[model samples]
Target: MDIATKQPGVLKPKVGSRSQNIMASRVVLTVLMFALGILMILPFLWMISASLKLQIDVFEFPIRWIPENPQWQNYERVWAGRYPFYRFYVNSIIVTVGATSLVLLTASLGGYAFGKLDFPFKETLFLSYLAMMMIPPQVLLIPRFIMFNWMGWLDTLTVLIIPNAVSAFGTFLLRGFYEQIPKDLSEAAIIDGAGHVRIWSRIIMPLTRPAMLALMIISAMWRWNDYLQPLVFLRRVTNYTIPLGLDFFVQENTAQMNLIMAAAVTATIPLLLLFLITQKYFIRGIVLTGIKG
Candidate 1:
């Protein structure tokens, strides 16, 4: 009648029969992943092929998988081509850096304040930010354009850079990250006579590098590839960013599909490089933020 006297017949096997099922599942997943990888790589392969091809080879009856002669000059041509792709690149870099810096500064401050501080109407203020997320960017486009025009910011760099600088999505992401910090840590800092600024500078920001990188990637990607905003804001061709500049190549090289693909491929490399550099932090930040939020 004792618990220790339990019979072996009542005991289940130590190893379950699910090993076969699990192995089968893994095999299926591997196949699925291989297919997905090929799918994702096709466009990039085509782009590179197009970038290297002669204008005629791009539209050859049997699509050329590899260029017989790689026009290494195509890259140089793209740099000096149509709308000054080099200038567009510089402009995109400038705007991307500025926007990313602004997002990091404001979102880190805003997220820290919301997550840690206990001021009046704090929840309400953050709720307002969350509400803004529901409002689609397209809905505010016309009004924002009008306001920027009134500010005499139309066609200016600020017209492109400032509006996207402070992202609600960034703030939302960082606030969740900030909340994950233990209150005891902040209290200890406070007990040491540390002000909010000291605690944020010394503690919060360092602990949230992943979150900051996420915001940087988000802000940079949006700013770099921002087509509609630049298209509408940049009236003059010389001031265009890569996305807006790409349009010129598309139009001018319409008959030369290879050249257009070359331009498209060129426009894409910076973003790919950016992602490659920060891929670890970017992916980790997203997964952690989603779990925490």
Candidate 2:
């Protein structure tokens, strides 16, 4: 009985020590993650602070997170400057919305077809489509520019919208999500005389809301912040999107750090708002994709 009691006492301390070690490791990980988060956000915090400080105060020796006298007029100057700032917002919204909508429609249809339907050369066609994603977008710039020039689409919003409308990444992402869905759902609908379009619209589409929302957010961010394509395809001042317009603003106001930061903040707000609003679905979609992948 003494030996048995001594064995329990030895094992209890070992188990307690193991639990304490795990708790210590967890605490350390939490601190490390918190530090990394602050490190990553420092640049953005500086941008916000600089936007509200005087030009001289922007890069002061001792950084001030909050200025004694915040320059509220910096934002006013950015918006009311000689350049048409609002026009950039309008152009960006138009291109982003148009491209994102088309991405959703095409991705959903393509994902459904690939995941649910089988036809001649189904695998071959998907592989070929997937191959396109391997090509660097810069490689297509010259050819796309030539084609757009020939078609008289240069310097027009159509050039922006049409090229970005179809997304290979979205199709791939949604296809992965769609494959995880039970095939029985589609089979059941088919037995009831439902067609592909009907089954996709009424059933599969609703179930993949997380994936679809994730695609929308990703597509919108891409189109909204695209710079090189807009720079190459667009020439007119009025046709300039936010990225191009911001470049022009920077060039004109190079010496004015406050106004430049203010412009950057203005351009960044929409994206921040979008992510904040859809963050839950966005994270869920990413997790599901990883799990299904």
Candidate 3:
């Protein structure tokens, strides 16, 4: 006779109780996650609501989830204001795109060499790069500023693009992804008369796409939202990026909270869109990197 059939009463109660416990635990976890998700989204909802309100209504006594009268014109004012916000948009796009592209190129090649190819002092070099990450970015500001000033790059878009073109973090993240790839694939490519370039391009790169996508999103976000670097490097008002331009606007129009919110919303939309578009790859990249590393 089967065990269940031989001990029906005992097995049934034990199995039922275990299942009930599991179901209860899952229910509690689900409720907690749902509440946390809502909490995280609340600030974004408030920002959207405030962007449509009148200046005087923004910080009114009690919180207003929705404005009584929406001021849609705030967006137009932000774009057409004396600050030339369009210029900031163009500058930001140029810098963000240029820096992100350069970072990907350098990081991929460096990661491949460090992770796959053999070379002298490779580990030592990579360890040094990792050590650099521990140094606070603030500590590098003076040296970078002086170097850029010497190169006559200050106040130019090149200043923004060149200084941050390569990232240690990008290299480290991509290296982890590359190391996770099986070496046998590279060996097979080599046997087929493929050089390192061909093996990297044809075999390794295609496999590590999720990691690259994550790096792209991360690099783009940092470049786009950078404030201090732009504030220090860019002098001309017309050359300002979105963050610096928004700060200027807030300073000039301190009383116009509605306009400020509109500007903030405009600055945030691109990042939101980027995350939405690559969210799947981004999450996969994070999980894979964490596990592999």
Candidate 4:
């Protein structure tokens, strides 16, 4: 009848052995995860390696992980603009900053309107927004290009920023966050003579810093990585974005893989830093948004 000796309804664990086994499993998993993280970073290692290599060493069969002579000048050469690399960096910054700014502002306002206002056709309007989201950017490319031409905006920053200024995804995301705010909060603000704009700026804006940061990371990454848009809109070498910059690197260099990799590594550094900085907020946003609406 004693609990220590009896098997009882459920068998008891051997406390010391079980604890050790769990600790051992955790240690193994920790090591495995560490190894996988290294594997993910391996290509970056090789990229840095190949960037420093000479053109011949790049294609060499037995690849050295590090160049015999670390070519620090490779970074300098990307800015040298023998191939418009610097130009492309400028172009990318302009488009990215512009597009991300527009996306954030427009999405925030649109999301607030949809979430807080009970205007006529509100449901229909949101559905229409959702419908537009379904229509892939590629499908709209031709019409958008023509529209830009009509407005004389092609190859201009306006052409790039205006099209992506409002994102349905952002609207949807922020609207969900907005809904989490009680109706009484906005009502009280209004009763205190706060206009919608005033409320948005003073009240809602301060609360949604994490959400905005999360949105910025998403939008910035997309714009930074987008190639097809830049390829289509920017025809001149001087107007190229980073993706286009890579193309010019190869074309101008005549298969100078070292320089190309060098330029690529240079370009990737910003995005990597971006990811590292906002990674915590980005993941937190994702997890928080999964809660029931």
Candidate 5:
């Protein structure tokens, strides 16, 4: 009887040890994540630092984390240069918006049709379209250039906007999201005399906002940083997008390291702002895609 009465508290030390182990593991994970975050952001810090330093100080021994003499004028010079940076910004904005809009419209419709609507050989057609994603864009570059040339679209904004109007990846992404929606909802809408157009517009589209937002962000980033297409298509200085304009700036001012960094920093601001604003939607889209798929 005495032994049994004394044994009630024996397990408490074991429970305390287990809790301590969990807390220790959490602390280790937190430290690792913090270190990784710092590592990832180091390049951005260096870029900003380089943008403020003089040309000669850029690669100085024992790399400078902070510039001794900050050159705020580097930004001014970049903006006020002979090559029009403002025009490049406007061109990027226009192309990014137009292409992103077209992608959203086409991808959503295509996804809806493939995921929900019945059609002849629908699976085959979607599979074929998905296969196109496997083909390298480089292989089609010459053919696309010739076709655009034939259409008299070279050296124009249309060249940038039209070719990227639709994306197979976008269609596939949205289709996966759409397929996760319950069939009962769509059937109920159909019984209520709603057409495919009405059902998609009213029910499907609103529910998949996260996927659409993700696509928008992705398309915008691709169009904004598009160096190769703009380089090949655009001929005139005034028609140059941000990437091409930056290349031209660098070519003209090879020794002006600070100026180049300043231009790069300016070019990066829009994408950073866009990501910061929509990161929630982007993360949600990715998570949902994984879960649904």
Candidate 6:
């Protein structure tokens, strides 16, 4: 009986020790993650600090997190200067919004057809479509430029918007989500006299909000940041998007780091706002996108 009582006492210490080990490990992990988060945000913090500082203070030995005398005029020079930076904002917004909308519409329709509909040579067509993605975008740049020139679209925002409107990746993303949706839902809709258009818009589209948001975010980011295509196509300074506009600012104000940083901060606000608003749905969409039927 004394031995049996000793066995229970020994087991209690082992269990307590295991719990303590787990708690210690968790505390260590939490500290590491917190450090990493701070590290990742440091660049943005530096940018903001530099934006508010004079050019001489930007590369100071011991970085100041905040400037003693904030130069709010850096932002004023960027916005009110002769460069027409506000026009760049308008052009970027137009192209990004237009491309993102088109991507969503086309990707949803194509995904619905591929994932839900019965048709001849469907797999072969999809494979062919996927094959297009393998071809280097640079290889087609010359041809696209020639085609745009022929169509009188060069130096226009249309050149920027049209190429990005259809996205192979977006279709692939939404198709996976669409496939996981039960066929019974579409069948029931059909029985209720709903056609393909109605089914796609009313029945199927509502269930795939997460995937749609993911695609929208992806397409918008791509269009917003595109430089190469705009550089190759756009000639007029008036037609420049944010990336091109920033490039122009950098060229003209090479010594004015403060002004450059201020311009960058202004350019980044829209994307930051977009993420802050839709991050919840974006995360949900990304998680649900991978689960297969």
Highest lDDT, which number? 2
For 91-188, candidate 6 gives per-residue lDDT tens digits of 99999999999999999999999999989999998998888868888998999999999999999999998888887878887788888999999999
What are the per-model numbers of colliding residue pairs? 0, 0, 0, 0, 0, 0
Clashing pairs in 4: none
**How accurate locally, in lDDT, is each candidate?**
0.80, 0.87, 0.85, 0.79, 0.86, 0.86
Per-residue accuracy of model 5 over 1-293 as CA lDDT, tens digit each: 23332244355547766556566667777798999999998888888899999888998879878899899989888888787688899998899999999999999999999889889999799889989989998888889899999999999999999889989988998998899999999999999999999999999999998888878767777898889899888899999999999899889889888888888887886678777897887666566555643
TM-score of each: 0.85, 0.86, 0.84, 0.88, 0.86, 0.88
Q: Which stretches of candidate 4 lie over 4 Å from their true place?
A: 1-13, 285-293
- Judging by lDDT, tell me the better candidate of 1 and 2: 2
Model 2 scores a C-alpha lDDT of 0.87
RMSD to the true structure for each prediction, in A, is: 7.0, 5.5, 5.6, 5.0, 6.1, 5.4
Candidate 3 whole-model C-alpha lDDT, 0 to 1: 0.85
lDDT of 5: 0.86
Q: Candidate 3 at residue 77, lDDT?
A: 91
User: What TM-score would you give candidate 6 relative to the actual structure?
Assistant: 0.88
Deviation (Å) of 223 in candidate 6: 1.2
Q: Which residues of candidate 5, in runs, are more than 4 Å off?
A: 1-18, 21-25, 286-293
The digit string of per-residue lDDT tens for model 3 on 168-214 reads 88899888889989999999889999999998898989998878887
